[model samples]
Target: MKPKRLYYWLMLAVGISGIGGLTYWDFYQVRIAAVTRNQRWVKSVSELLHSEQASMARWIEKFSIESATFRDIANSRRDVAALILIDNRNRQAQRWVRPGLRLEPLDPRVSVLQLRALETQKTTMGPVLIIQAKPYFTVARPLGKNRALIVFLDAARAWGLLREEASLWHIRASIYDFEKNPMFSSFDPVIPAGALAQTLDRARSKETSGIVRLPRRLSWKWLITFHFDPASDWIFLITQHTTWAYAPVIFFVICMAGILLIARIPFMALVGTRREETAQALAQFAGRVDSYIRGRDAMLQDPPSGIKELFPIAATARWLIPQWKRAEAFPRDLALERKLLSLLVESLPEGILFFNAQGGVQLSNELGRVFLSLEQEGREARMVSGVQVPRGFLEPYLEPVFTGAQPNLGKEVDVAWADGKHLYRLWVERVEAEQDKTGGFIVVVRDITFRKQWDYVQEQVLSGITHDLRGPLSAVLGYLDLMKRQLGDGAAAKVLEYLRMAREAGVRLSQMVTDILDVVRFEQGKIDLVIEVIPVVDVFQRIKNTFGVIAEQKKVNLKLAVLGDSNMTASGDRKLLDRVLDNLVGNAVKFTPPEGSITVTVRSENGRVLFDVVDTGRGIPREAQSRIFDKFQQVRPGDRSAGYGLGLAVAKFIIEAHKGEIRVESEVGIGSRFAFWIPIRPPDHRAAGKSDALVNMDPNEVVFPPPAA
Candidate 1:
């Protein structure tokens, strides 16, 4: 084998070993994570056991000869089902049975719960027993002088306590006796005693806590985390599916394996014997070909090669020199052209960087050098551009083009660099000399930090100006209304007509200001949704009442339809929904010409509420439907004065804030149908005002859900 083969084998082995190590480490971490998650509940149960043991010991000390002691025990300990006390002489007894339980007293001499504790004179907990459909167990300790105290504990209560903690951690918890008998479980059907013992048997013998797998016959192989508490003399087990622990790591392994295979394919091709064998055979036959072709003196005494199969190669080589020289011959001034090209590339304001097929920098302008921080300053273009682009700087932006996954210059990628002190917009153009073998990329970088900051400041300025206009606009409308009301029926016909015109102009201007302010807020994510339950039909009725007069003035037919339970309710910002409905219905009224028909439809479907506003006027053009909801977009761009072109955009924002979507389907000559859907039960969240009350996100950056498939 060649040295290359050995080297490749060693690389392959190393890659496989690394992959194996990564997979093993991931699994180990997953196991530890699972153990950690289970530890929380296990610790809780252990604490409960310790507290209960201590409480029982204290209760025995706190017990009194008074009649109130039984009542006190009942109130203090819900787990106590019964309490028995034998007098010092064993002849006298005082017993208290918890309400709702009955058990005949046995001779203290024959009572097994006390027998062992009496002999040892120590406190001990005994085996479990069933009483009146509830599990019970005993805590026994000897009093002075042949007397004993036995308290019957309600195991059901203990189980209930465990259930709460187990539910909190979303895992099943149980306790087993030293003999592996199941006593208490948070869920049912509880793990069988035999199964519990079998699972515990799989655990490491000396380990107090470890992960164990259940038998395949009993399950799809679930895993359990068992913890033995020596102080309580009980084994606690937290059970969860194995998928919980292994799924993420298993997925990671699969992804890593695919990447490794892709990386190794080229190496395998390079190390293959086919290319080497073909090269060696050609070399043996054409041994003298290079010396004979390059030197005129060497060909006079001997054959160009010793082998017989090289006449065609010998002819081609003899003719190759003149052809090669002719192909490179050019009449242009090469040095001057090079000087001009360098000057032109270096004079550009933007940065230009050239990268070869292997992702090594081939050349760059002085600006590109500065952009990449290769040097603080440079006057000349970099000729020996041997450095690589910073890792991850270009991969996200250019890898798709290199792999043919994306077309060249299809998208612009803007990235923040230097801890966000600077931002750059980058474009990549692929340069290919042929379909295969030769390719490179020309990356253009434009600094846009100042432009971005200017846009932000402009938005702030516009927002302030638009907001200030609202007050004056409101005052103008208020005075106009007051004047018209006071001058009612007394003003001349021409005067009334002029006043109406002024009021109409004021109303239109006021609406424009309001829309401008609203759009700014929505884009900046400053508008908070006032989420509440909304009556869908009621909102439709109000729109009908308001727009019915407008439709009448235009001689258009206005109608309303309630589908699928008119009483259906939706969860969202009631005011916002009203705004959305107003936009759709108002647009229908405005655009519908004389004698046209408009219908407002409301319905509930599949746990969501749907609204559709259909109009029979000149419909939205089909080509413009896609971006009808975009800011400042309109179907009739030629008619800019019709409105500010913000109604649909504002409507879309409101619907999206409710986690809903709005869309339009239109045919140019036919009518248009605008539809939107919002979930009937929106998720529980703070109102969209602030993180302290609503969402935690960069308020300046408005993030919308991806378009539906």
Candidate 2:
């Protein structure tokens, strides 16, 4: 066993043994002593009774002799009592009789003579004075053999006196008559005489004086009886209820011993074990003197302010500080290895490869498999290298990650397969593993496909942009020339209208330039947000006015519906938001067939203000929707002369910058709905600018005078 375990068991045994010894002592020694003391007390009462009986006998004999005027023994006793006391029959007994004597019936049988003058004549004595009956012993003695003298004595009083003397021994006493009647008791008798009669009879018949049990008439049954005889055929009994005299002390002593054995012993053993454990622990700690000093110094140098903050720090220092020192070397070496590996990969045209700590391939670049001709190889062909090679055949030149017991890097090996058509340079590098047993590697692939496709798309897009830009510039230059030519013509109304048309064309070109610039700026994150609260109604009104003219020119009907309260508003950059509304509404007006109706609506929903522009237009196709918001991407084969595709992309950027969202839903035949939502509450810090409101008045409110002819 361990020393600690042995010590615990030894101490526990000692505690148990000590408690067992104490319990035995209490039950046997202490309990027996109590019982013996009580018995002694009862014996002392018996001795007292014997002494009192002798004294009473002597007193009676002397009194009988002194009062004699004898003719013969019995006749003289009676005649002398008759001569001395019969004449005083008329007097009260208390005035004539002495303290212990009473004269009632006396036999007149003989003569009387004085003790000084007469000769003694002996005959049988008469009976003693008859006494009144009571619940106690009555002492009677014959003046002659057949005659008797009786004295009334309360036996309960004598028992009470005995109890008083024996109080220190916890002895209790009570007196009973021949009929088992209580005459006197030291304590209030818990039992009546009837319940005890049988036991008392047994005690009387057997002439026994010891503990005898009996049931009480009222409460308890068990009692101890001690009998003493003071005269022939008369008994003095001192009985005590056994429960009070002996049972309580015995029970108390037993319970105390049990408590010590069961409770205190175990507790003391546990405490001793804990104390020894603590001492051993202290000794163990003292053995590490240097560590103890270091820990103490650390604690004293930087005492933690609280448990919450300091415990984690202490635990970390105990474990991680040494680990950190060991870990530093590995990571530094691994970092250098990684740098060199990356450089080696960058130097090569073909990709390099690496693996995780478990020696499993983690990263792969383009040329890795092509170098070995394993790209299309079957499972059998791919399992060439000895790395956890899956069940397969050997390929031309494939290698597995090599992770020795310690991390290691392998040399570069060229993989040439199938007539030198495919080539690859494979480099494997080792990485430091995590404590959790995971490691990682890097792989680079070089595919010559990029070098092949580069020249193709670049030429196409550049040529397209040039053609697209030149057409708009040509129209603008042509319009400017016409306006410059018209500046000299000045041909009144018709010429001014022509100049206006030319300026309008130039304005279109300028708008295209502005759209392109906005698209670039948005993509580069240079666009600034001027956020403010703009009313929903105002945005609807702006959309209506801006697109209504265009709709009219196209012969499309533009309608406005303003819902929700007038106070409802949205927070965003008003100018940019106006641009978004313009683009959406303008598109609706542009795409819708002549006489088709377009509607602009604004409402509040779900803690946000929403704007919707719906148009009965030819909607976008499903395939085009994915790329619709991309810069320079236009709907397929649309009227390309009017604008480039930067408008919707710019609108998407602006809405996103304002922390709002926009989406389009359309069915090609059913037309489209472009909706956007923005927060209703403006920031407390930024002031809002006014939005010019537009109202869709009730038709009844419109009154018109007859047109003048």
Top candidate, metric lDDT: 1
For all candidates in order, the CA lDDT equals: 0.68, 0.52
- Give the Å shift of residue 218 in candidate 2: 97
Residue 123, model 1: Cα distance from true site in angstroms: 99
Q: What are the root-mean-square deviations of the candidates from the true structure over C-alphas? A: 33.8, 25.6
Residue 573: error of model 1 in Å?
2.4
Candidate 1 contains a number of clashing pairs equal to 0
| Clashes (N, CA, C under 3 Å) per candidate | 0, 17
- TM-score for all models, in order of appearance: 0.35, 0.30
On TM-score, the leading prediction is 1
Worst 10 residues of 2 by lDDT: 690-699
Candidate 2 Cα deviation (angstroms), residue 387: 41
Error of 1 at 286 (Å): 55
Clashes of 2: 17
Q: Can you write out model 2's per-residue Cα lDDT over 1-709, one digit (the tens) per residue? A: 6665566567656766665666566545644454456556656765676565555445445665436532232342221222222112252221122234443452222112111112222221221222343222323333333233333333444455666785765555665544454544566554446646655776568654544444344225344555634332233344443354444446656665665566556567776987786666545434443363445434312322322344454555657745665687788889899788766665666665555543355444445534433444454422222344322211111223232221211222323545553322222333446673435543434443444245236435544675578677777777677766767665687867867787777677667766765654554456766667777777777676666677788899888776758767778778988888888887887789997988777777656666778888888875566456656778775768536777888887776555555666666987877776666665322212111110111212212211111
